[model samples]
Target: MTTRTRTTTVTWSQANARRLDRQSLGGSGSPALGVTEAVAAMLGAHAQVLSAAELAVGVRAPGVTRAEVRSALWTDRSLVKTFGPRGTVHLLPAAELPMWTGALSAVPGEAARLPGDARMTPEQVEAVVTAVAEALTGAELTVDELSDEVIARTGPWAGDPVMPAFQGMWPRWRQALHLAGHRGVLRYAPNRGRKATYTNPGTVPLPGPQATHALVRRYLHAYGPATPAHFARWLGAPRGWAGQLFEGLAAAGAIEEVTFEGVGAAWVAAGDTAFPRSGPRGVRLLPYFDAFAIASMPRDRLFPGAAGDRALAGGQAGNFPVLLVDGTVAGVWHQRRSGKRIAVTVEPLAALGGGRVRELERRVARLGEVLEGTAELTVGAVTVGGHA
Candidate 1:
């Protein structure tokens, strides 16, 4: 078993964070690359960004106007980017998508490593993908319904629609989605449906693993102060396989390990980059799944609840957009849309000053633009300020 090294010191904290896993949601892993630079790299060097609301913070910035980032993830790759570095679906960079997904492909039964019946053969698999892609040309379907339809059609590799043969195949079903996803042939319905539904992959073959490793390395660089264990969890790859692959990459000098606290992890340097520090400037408004929020899986090390809150409450599911005052969750924000009007209300758990309130308003306004509407931002008082 790999050992753990513990180092607790203020001076080394920043570098230490880089040693951990990375979240590929918003930008690159390197603080060195600004938003635009990372976005460009993630979207195949030249890609379109999207305009969406309350996407996860760093993973799904509502502000991204690039179409390639949004539409393609659903349509071609079928895999969504997220912060599994700590179990959140943070934004995943497009280039790195295939490896993250392909790795997931081999994680199930050992049979995954071998070939199966005709229906499960490579030819059959491609046919299933084609038929599913054809079916979802302009519609959405839940996995249950889509898999059933694909199985019944008798197109390429054929299978019985309602037989025991089709039970417990979410991963297989997910593979179809991935095929469709890599092809830019599917997308998720907004707010998602009762079940996860997919749209069409407009056109294009998907990325592969070589691309994924490249992308993930950059993600860790920017969101450093993380670990390899964290990345293994995030990529959803087998620990055994990932180590071998990552180690090979490291040996070739493709990756490096950052050390602190007597321990080190595989890492890529994000030189000359710095996250906003908490000091006289004590707060930052964070989007849900924001890099800062999920940067470290065990967040207590950085957040207010480091030693107490047993259950992890803040992430893609549990927490919404937040108000971070002094590097901790100071409050939460609720965003609502009425046609072209966006309303933002902050429920502060503590007090605040006027300048901070104004700054928040400005931040919200930027969010409104990304959300594509006018906005009204309100900051409630904390104990020193007021109450909810």
Candidate 2:
């Protein structure tokens, strides 16, 4: 005789409430986690735009200033800025670079799928990766400078055209740059001028299946009660591969299946099913690529009606800043800095209660403090996605 494990069941609201707490967006009432803790909580914030990354951290960790976030990245070396999931820049704790890099590198590259004209020989790819690691160690170099060094070390074959873009040809060697970052060999240097630069984060690469497993656990802990498909989408992994990983984890009892109302069975890290039913506590102004905005899925629940259409474009979230009232995205917002003043405009999908508006104002004030300026809030209809 055998007994079957019972799957936990929850409503979307229940899961989201826990997700809010885990993401550190449960409102100020939720204890303010430190910068490192917050980044680790959400795996890593989406950081394609550095400013968006700064604000994403600021909103979750109360009293955190943008300067302080920069200090953590450059001065203290507590946070590492590098290319991460979906081949986008992200801020991961420096201590955890090995795990992230190892996991990311373990995923197979799509070299075979590239057009014949664009594909680099495996030998060429390896040489470029090695050259990048060598050139960036112990010093920061701009892309142009690094490109020159790679060309010098690996021969002209490394610089062949991968593809032609509106700007120019994307080089073969450049394809490995993000791979180099993911393998823990390189990271972004603080912008000294208009050009982007790279540096070694001073960590050795540790590639393995365990690292991938660790990443799966970390992802599920922060954004789980989800399916392998969800994990694949989030990490940009191949669907079959992600599904196998999820299956193995479940067989090992590292994760358990949960059934969410209106959503089918999904996996969450084991012992992660008890989510509080309470909604979030305060209003929040989330910048572009805020982890909460992008990480949460079946997004219609988070972005009902026109809110989804406004905040997301072409199935990508974070084209515009989001206004979170209670636990859901209530509207969209944008800010323009004019010297010492930041002019902010909020475009709510529906009229907000007077108290909620005031709470949003307080959030705006916090942004002002983060920017070291006076932030003025104006209520109006914003043409979302028009301006940066």
Candidate 3:
């Protein structure tokens, strides 16, 4: 006789609150984690905007200043900045670099749709990766410096400006930059004034064949009871491949299927089906591209009702600085710095009561502390557009 698979069901509110708790955004009772610890817990912090990444870590760790976050990345060498989930810049815990590199390297490279002239052949990609590793060894180099070195090592074709960037074309080798990073060839080094730099991170251990499986479990722990499609979206992997991965895990009893309210079928780590009896309650100010806002699934649930219209940018998370109330986005906000003071403007979907108002003030105060500035709160229209 075949055993029927059991599906556990949960309310969206329960999932939200559980994610908040798991992410250390639940409340004041949450422990003040260290910088690396906080980043590791969130899997990684979106870091395209350095200031926002600092705020992301600061909010979760509480009292970890922007300077300290930088220290972890550059001085302490406890965190490494590299291309992370969705092919975006992120600050990930240094110790987990091997696993991340292994898992990301395993992701099938998306076929570049660029014209034949603009794309690098598979052999050219490998050559560029090797050159990048060799060029950055024992020394940090700025983009231009790295480009010159890469060109010298791989001939002029590596420096042919063909890949379009912001307003101009970047070198063909630049296209393989993220791939090299995922292979543990190089990482972001401390900036020289305003110039970004890169350096080889010595040697990273090769990940076991189960590295991808390990990452799947990690993702489910942080944002579980989620569908394979959610995992695909988060990792920027192919949807069918993600589904197959989840299916394999289920077959091995490493994960189990579940029914998420309003979300239909999903999967979570096996035997890990508990949810908090009460939903989370509190106020949180998340900066641009904050990991929690970006990774949580069923965007409609996290940004319920009007929040979907107000907080997201064209259905993409992390475009706006979000205001979280009871584990769901309830408002949008923006901040501007003048000298040592930061002025915060908020536009809530609904009126906040006296208690919540006080909580919001406290959160703003903490944000100021994290930024090493004095912050003033104004509950009104946030006239600013979504950040780039």
Candidate 4:
């Protein structure tokens, strides 16, 4: 007679996937900035500010300073401010911004909608369009060059001061660029002219019929097991459009779908492994808008109670840099310096201890050198409440 025993293997949750992004991307995944360079590729062209956000979002680490941003130049993930989607400055992967920008503007007249809150008329958009067409008639130019040409031709092209102004134009412009990226019209290239410049994709090939399909596939590889709704939010596309991209990829055998607890697991790559079961816990000093908290479309799964209020606190602004402990969003963090030294103030939902505490401090110390001055740290009370 024989007796039987039962055993089970557990997989990680969507929440765990977020943490995996950190490990996979943080300097381990890509060597040239190589694979990791994909981080910039996925986000499109980014700015230091957005890079900070990228860290918060788990695409990169936070407390990164301007010097560090500049350090990314050349390699694979350098800072190239190409105009796409919203004519905004995105701190994107230097290599892929062109494809991304081209995809965003794929269809003709696609950029006509939204335009801006000012709602520039078609004629107005056309004027700007004409200016762009003329400027890129032969070759690509840097944002400064592009702006110079545009302003020289039309007086002012809107994004004068940069940063904040550019942040606003992402609606229509981003859509246009996203569509354009799908078609391969524009591509990223080394500028040599102080800043990197973007030129016409000039006959490079991109994924076919599955245009958005190819793009979204990368999204999953980088930020997957996500829902259509979440895809829609991150890519800045409509839910229906997101669904189309999702299905297109799945249909093409580009990805695999699994149903998990929250929002129902949705999609991932063909051979990707679900995370291994997470154990007790730990602490992490993540950046604002960090992916750990904001990866999913709904935003509620990981941050159950107050994700909405806290994330939107800056006026529907965006997520702040977050702190994590034991597989959940713990709170937020701020990095300050006293002249030659750096300090990290972490506010947590619970008092972090032992391993988690030491771990966060080490991570912060490493990030600090990659940030301001000499490396240093200072913890603020460890409030068990949350982001105070």
Candidate 5:
């Protein structure tokens, strides 16, 4: 006779509180994690907007300053800026580059939906990536300089200006830029004046066969109990592929399925099933593209009622700065800086009690401290647009 595996059930509130604790966003008096440690804890900080990334780290690490975050990236070489989850810019821990590269490289590539003439064949892509690695070794080059070097090394086909970008066309070879980053061949360098530069990060060891499995486990630890579909969306990978990968892990006894109340079946890292008795009990001001807002699953629960309409942009998370009360989105906020002062506007969906209002005031003050500016709070509508 075969015995069925027992499944544990968790409520959304309990799950959110557990995740908040895991993410180090529980409340005041949390451990003062270093910049690199904070970034690693969050998997990575979304850095398409560099200031937002700095604030994301600052809020999690209590007294960390923006200068320290930059120092870690440029001075100490503890963090590296590169394409991470969803193929977006992120600040990842330098030591974990091998695991990230390995897992990202293993993600099935989506067919480019570009015009036929603009697309590169597989062989051409390989050549372009190889040329990019060779061009960026031991030196930093701006996009224009790198393009010139790559075109010279790989021939004219690479330089074809057919791929449309913004107001103009980009070279065909540029299509492989993110792929090179994922392969650990290229990374961001300090800007020269106003121009961005790239460089080779030197030799990165190939990830072991279990690298992808390790990544899945890490994701579960941070944002479980989650479904394979949720992991696929977070990674920008194919849903079916993620499902198969999760099935393989389950077979290996690396993960266990559990039932989430109000949600269906989900998986967590093996033996990682415990949760807090209650949900979070504080206020937080999260910046644009904050990892917690983006990676947490069952979005409807995190952004409930009117929050689903206000916080998300076209059903996509992290487009707007969010106000978190009790681990769920309670409002939207916008910050404007003028000299050393920052003006913050918050639009809460409902009225707050006296204590929560006081907590909100303190949270805004902390935001100013993290930004190295004096911040004043105004409880009103946030008129600024998404990512403004």
Candidate 6:
């Protein structure tokens, strides 16, 4: 007789509710204490746009300030800003760099050819990565300063144009920068003026195979009951590779397959269960590249109908600050600063009850305090997603 496999069925509402709870967006869990804890809890906070990353933590940590996040990155040395999943800049706990780098290395690098048919030879790529790591080991240097160091370390060849793009000439070292970060050797230092700088992620043991597995488990812990494709998209890894990893984990009994209502099959970490059915969540203002806003797949469910059309551009999520009503994207919002006041404007796709609107105002006021300004909210018309 064959032993039959059992698959748990989860409802769409249940899955999303659990996700919101895990993401710390529904007030179900204790708030993280500071940037380091906040970034660790989310596995990593998206940091491609530095300000957006700060806001993402502020919303989840409650009472966290931009200065606190900055201190964590530069002063406290508790968090490190580095190229992470999808080759995107993310803020990760300093000590966990090894695990992140190990996992990120599993993703293949971008194509070697640049726009002008200028190709980076494998040796040049390796040399550039090494030079960047050495150049940033303990010092914080701006882009131009680092470029000078790279040229000194690896000769002018490292500074050749790898591509001709709007950002001017994309250099060979620029291509290797993300790769160096993924290798756990470099991170972004806090801005000292108007210029961006780079630094080492502090000393940590280089990770091994176990680190990659740990990274996968961490991803599922924060955003699981998700498909392989979802994990692949999140990591910028190929779907086939993600699927293989998921299958291996399943075979090892590290995770179990589950099916969601109106959605297909997904994997959840072993012994994990959905949250109990509960009342709806409150309104929230999430900034651009907020991790919660982009954590799951079949984003249509999160951004339904008109919300999808309005909140996503070219299938890209996280370009705009989102208004979440009851755990789903209901609108898009923008903010501008004038003197000591932050003027917030919301454009709802559907009616937000008077009570919720007031609550949203409270949240905005809290955000204003974090921004060190008084927040003034103005309800307005619905608009498409993207920075205003």
Question: Can you write out model 1's per-residue Cα lDDT over 1-388, one digit (the tens) per residue?
Answer: 9998443332234443332212232223423433333433232221111232133322223345334344545555433432223222334444544443444333322235323432265676677767777777777777666767777663423443322334443434444445455444454444354455655635443244564455456545554434565555544455676566567666776665554333344354333234323222334555543444544444544445521232135322223456665445667676667998977788666557888777777667766665657878776522221111
Clashes of 3: 0
Model 4 ranges with Cα > 4 A deviation: 1-15, 18-69, 74-79, 83-88, 107-127, 136-148, 151-210, 279-281, 291-293, 306-318, 381-388
| lDDT of each residue in 56-85, candidate 2, tens digit only | 888778788888888998899899989888
What is the descending TM-score order? 5, 3, 2, 6, 4, 1
Task: Please give the ranking of all candidate structures by lDDT, highest first, separated by commas.
Answer: 5, 3, 2, 6, 4, 1
lDDT digits (tens) for residues 1-388 of candidate 6 = 9997788887767777777676667764634456677788777888877778888888877788888988888788788888888778899898888788877865766555465446667898788878888889889999889889988999877778765657688666787788788887778887879888888764453554577678778887777778888888877878887888888888999988888667678888888866547634788999888887777766888898888888888778888788989878999999888898898899989877899889999989978877778989999963443753
Clashing residue pairs for model 3: none
- CA-lDDT, candidates in order: 0.47, 0.82, 0.90, 0.51, 0.90, 0.79
TM-score of 4: 0.67
Which lDDT value does model 2 have at 199?
Answer: 92
Give per-residue lDDT, candidate 2, residue 316: 76
| TM-score of each prediction | 0.58, 0.95, 0.97, 0.67, 0.97, 0.93
lDDT of 4 by residue, 162-227 (tens): 222434532222222323333344444565756766655443434444445666666666666667
Q: For each predicted model, how many residue pairs clash, with residues at least 3 apart or on different chains?
A: 62, 0, 0, 53, 0, 0
Model 4 gets an lDDT of 0.51
Better of 4 and 5 by lDDT: 5
TM-score: model 2 vs. ground truth: 0.95
Candidate 3 runs further than 4 Å off: 1-3
